[model samples]
Target: MEFDGKTFLTALGLAFILEGLPYFLLAERMPTVLRFLSERPAPELRRLGLTAILAGLAVVALVRW
Candidate 1:
């Protein structure tokens, strides 16, 4: 995807925020998710991460186009 200066900056800023969400959202449950990952591997984590990536991409796409 492409982006202008402001779009890229905004997407980058939002990405920084989103990257911190699980920590904020699952304060006490953080270990649970970590342990779950240790016991069972799944693609959901990757997909969830990709969702944010796609969100940034979409923002850039919209802003630049």
Candidate 2:
């Protein structure tokens, strides 16, 4: 699939809204993301993975928005 810059950004913004929606509605049963962040003993791998996720999301958001 190929999308121009603006189309890519709109799709990305929708994705973030969708992903964050579940967590917003299910705060009591937080996703692994939340749990890992709260854990005092989080592993290095977990931090790296989370950083990648956030960075990727940021790029998509900026590009598409």
- lDDT by residue for model 1 (1-65), tens: 66589977997798789879999988899899788877754687787779977997898799879
lDDT of 2 at 15: 83
Give lDDT tens digits, candidate 2, residues 1-65: 77589977997899899889878888777867677666656587688789989998899799879
Candidate 1, residue 33: how far the Cα is off, in Å: 0.7
| TM-scores of the models, in the order given | 0.51, 0.42
**Model 1 alpha-carbon drift over 4 Å, by segment:** 1-3, 42-65
**Residues forming the 10-long window of minimal summed lDDT in candidate 1:** 36-45
lDDT of each: 0.82, 0.81
Q: What would the TM-score be for candidate 2 when compared with the true structure?
A: 0.42
* Clashes per candidate, residues 3 or more apart or on different chains: 0, 1
TM-score of 1: 0.51
Error of 2 at 33 (Å): 9.6
